[model samples]
Structures are given as structure tokens and as C-alpha cells.
Target: MRTSTTMPPLQALRAFEAVGRLLSFRRAGEELLITQSAVSHHIKQLEEMLGVRLFIRKAKSIELTPEGAAYLERTVEAFRIIAGATSEMRRQTARQRVRVSVLPSFAANWLVSRLADFMLKHPEIEVELEPTLRLEDFASDYADLAIRFGTGRWEGVRAEWLMNEEMSPVVSPALYDDGTRFAEPKELLLQTLLESWNPVGWELWLGEVGVDIRRARVLQLTDYNIVLQAALNGQGVAIGRMHMVRDHLAAGRLLQPFPQIVRSEKIAYWLVMPQNRRLRPGAEAFASWLKEEAASPPSPVC
Candidate 1:
């Protein structure tokens, strides 16, 4: 029989794991719904039981000692295995769910519209969508998969190429009506330019066409979706991402005024998953579906 003296306290181990993962006793306490003093006491007791120092205290912050880092890796993996087993047992008795983390703009303009089809096809699997600008940690239970806009390179994850990013000037039909054409790129300097989080698209395109952006009237917005909305309202011209605006352009809701298309060198969409981690069946299905969807041809430009 296992004796109490031979086994480390589960509470202390839990506290230590949380502190090691977050590198802050206060944060661990907050997450565990305990007091900072309690968290420190648990860590101290854990270190004493293990006969090793686990953290290096600093003036403002703390860091895991070398021994703590090694122990953390094993502890985290153990927790992951336990969580996986629990999830598997639950899945065996209930519908499987896949948690997907995605960028807000992509979720709003691209993925959400097609989700109904996925749902119809895979009735056994449920999907939870988490849309945020912040990246998800695959090591945690944050998400099963992530759709990220990047260069297909992230540490500890396998990034499958989704699609290349292309941008061009788009305007509402009202702005393009009356047979009004700006023959010269410089003529656009007189029109309102809608700006998103990063105004690099407009800067790049204007520079490529030798147009000075200093003369252009700019309306800055917080999100790409909002910028597109403004453009749809005929308020200004927006640098539209091809993938996001293809349907709108095809439907005559938006029009590409300029023929020049700019390709982004540093950014593209990617399907990301944890490296060497076995994906749940639900996640695998979603990934396969996403690949098929990406391979399909775009809507014809109207």
C-alpha cells in the first residue's frame, strides 16, 4: 500500500506545476483560486519534498530553476496525458468537439459562412470557434487547431500552407459608378484611403505605383472587417485582401478599381497544429475539410 509519507502532496504538485508554467506564484494562485501565500507555501513544501530548489527569486519576477524546468516538462506532459484520457473517455460516450482558434477577420469573412456546410457534413463532431488576435498555445487546452496568418513557421507546431495573400484597391460600386475612371495612379491621391490595423498594404501598393501617400486622405479603422464595411458604404477605398473580398467583389458589392495586385511577402494563411501530437478524429476531419475548401476555385469576379 502507498503511504502518505512516500507520496508528494497533490496540492503542492498542482501549485508547483501552475507556478512553473506561468513563472509567477501570484498568477498561479489566481488561476488555482488560492492565496499567494498558499501558493508560495505549496511551492516551498514541494521543493523541500523534492530536495531541490525550483525557482530563482528576483526583485520583480521569478524564473524556474534548471531543475524546475526539467521537472516541468515531465509534469506538463503527464497532465496532458491525463487530460487526453479524460477527453477520450468523454468522447466515447458523447459527441466529439473540435476547438479551433482563428483570426477574427478570417472567422467573420471566410470561415463562418462555410461552417454550416461542415456542420451538415459532420453531424457527429461539434466545433467551437475562438476568434482573437492573440495566438493560441497548443501545449495547453486552448485549441485543437489554429488558422493563423503567418509565414508557415511557428515553433513547436506544424504549419500547413493554406493560401497566399494578395491585396488590391477595392471600392463600393457607387464609387466606381458614373463611368468615372482614375487613369493615373496619382489621381487616387485625391480620394479617401481606408486604413486597417497595419497600413502597410496601401503603403506598398502606392510605393509600387509611384504614388505619394502623403497627399491621400486617410480614414483609419481598427479592424479589416470594419475597413471593408466602410468601403462598402462608399466612404473610402480600402486595400482589400483577395480571399476575404472575393465573394463581395463577385456579387458587385465591392469593385477592384486598380488592376495592380500586391502580394504579401511575409503573410499568408496557415493551418497550424501541435508538432507530433496526435490529432483527435474531429480535428483531423476539420483539417481535411479545410484543405479541400482551400483548394477549391474562387468565386468568379463580377
Candidate 2:
């Protein structure tokens, strides 16, 4: 018997597949959560290992070479088969835990409160939630489903509209009492704006109400939680994702000074799953329950 050393690393294969499909190193890196230089290195390593040039790199673009095209088909099929097997195994298990990947902001602000109803209803299905900004690769046997915030146009994936999104400015009651009032759009320009992961928010809100201030002060925070916390601490007024701030506003913890709200046209929360794949036993139940839970809360977007 002889042992063979002919298998390529999974990272290299994934990089190759992403690049081959997208035809751009930068886009592939964005999808795979690697640097463009790293993707280039992986392709270079893979090409060296196989002793063949995989991409015909040009000054502005890249195209898969003959061998690369051939290899891409096999790589894609291999990932698909592995994903199918994993899905099948999950379905076979009677109580496979429901693993859901979600954005941290949405998890903290919206889902966590409603999730108890789901657990209570479906006691047999245990659930694990992974919160991160990185998009889950469904072919890697990780998450059964994911709640993604986007325009519902992920490549090679199935996305269903979960909720609409709106933006507004929110502040603490103490900030209001301290005389930093957003009575008009001009006042917003005068004060420091709190921005979470989305930096374009203040600009977008300002543009929506036709208040252009080139040098509005912004306090940037890494996550929505921090941004909201800072706003609660009277640090600054945050451009609130309405879904996240609605409860706070209702509870009088946060104040919405102005009435104007912008309904985001480009993006919303979407329930995303692997394209052409069935959910696992637990995931199937969880997915159904999630939709039911999400059905009525968000007011209709006009």
C-alpha cells in the first residue's frame, strides 16, 4: 500500500473557486475573508503545486486558464457533494441543534427577546447562535442558516426578506435635558454624531433631510452595542437603525427628537441559506418558527 500526497489545502481550493467564479482577486478576498494579497498567494501556491498557470492575469483583469476552468468545475462539485452529505446527516439526526449565524446588532436588539418564544414552543430543538459580521460559507458545514443584513442579492445563495430597515436619530433623555436638542436638522449638524459599523449613516440621514454639513463631528464605534451604549451615556446622538432603537424609544430609554425617518431602499434584513439545499431537521423547524416570529412586528414599508 502506498500513501499519496496529492491533496490541495481547503483554503487554496476555496480561494481558487472564489476567484475562478468571480474573476477578480479583490472580490474573492472579500467573500473568503482573506486579503487580496493572500488570495494571490494561495493561487500562486496552488499553481506551483500543480505545475500549471491557473489564471491569465492581465493589467486590469483576470481570466481562468484552460486548466483552471477544468479544475474549478471539480472543486465546486466537491464542495457541493460535501455540503449535501452534511445536510443529509443533519436531517437524519432527530434532535440536531439549530445553528444560526446572525449579525450582532440584530441579535442583541431584536432576536434575543423573541427567541424565548421559539425555544418554549419547540423544546426538542436546541439552538445555538453565532454572532459575527463575517458572512457564513454554507458549504463549509458550519451554520444551518444565517440572518444577513443586505440587499438580498448574495451570489449562489437563497435569500428571503425578513424585515425592512429604517434610520433615525436617537438620544438619551439626559442629553435632551442638557439642551443638545435635535429640534432641526441644523442642530444635528452642530452636535457629535455617534456611528456604529455603518459610517455612511449620518451622511445618509443628513442628505435625506437636505441638511448638508461638511464637517459634522462623529464618534465612531466598532459595534452597534457600543454606539447605543454611548448614546445612552449622553455621549452623542446615534443614527439609530429603527429596528434596534424602537424598543428603547418605547421604553423611554432613548428619545427620537425629530419626526423624519428614512426608509432604506437598498438594504434590509434577509434570511439566507445555501442555494438549492434543504434545511436540517432542527433548522427546518427553526426556520419556520423564525418566519412566524418575524411575520408581524415590522410595520409595512411604504
TM-score, one value per model:
0.63, 0.65
Residue 1 CA displacement from its true place in model 2, Å? 55
lDDT per residue, candidate 2, 111-201, as tens digits? 9998899888888788999998777778887899999876788788898888777788899999878866555788787778998666667
Instruction: List candidate 2 stretches off by more than 4 Å.
Output: 1-93, 298-302
Q: Local error of candidate 1 at 263, Å?
A: 2.7
User: Mind giving the per-residue lDDT tens digits that candidate 1 earns over 119-180?
Assistant: 99998889999987666768777799999886676787888998877888888988767555
Clashing pairs in 1: none
Model 2 scores a TM of 0.65
TM-score, model 1 to reference: 0.63
- lDDT score, residue 30, model 2? 100
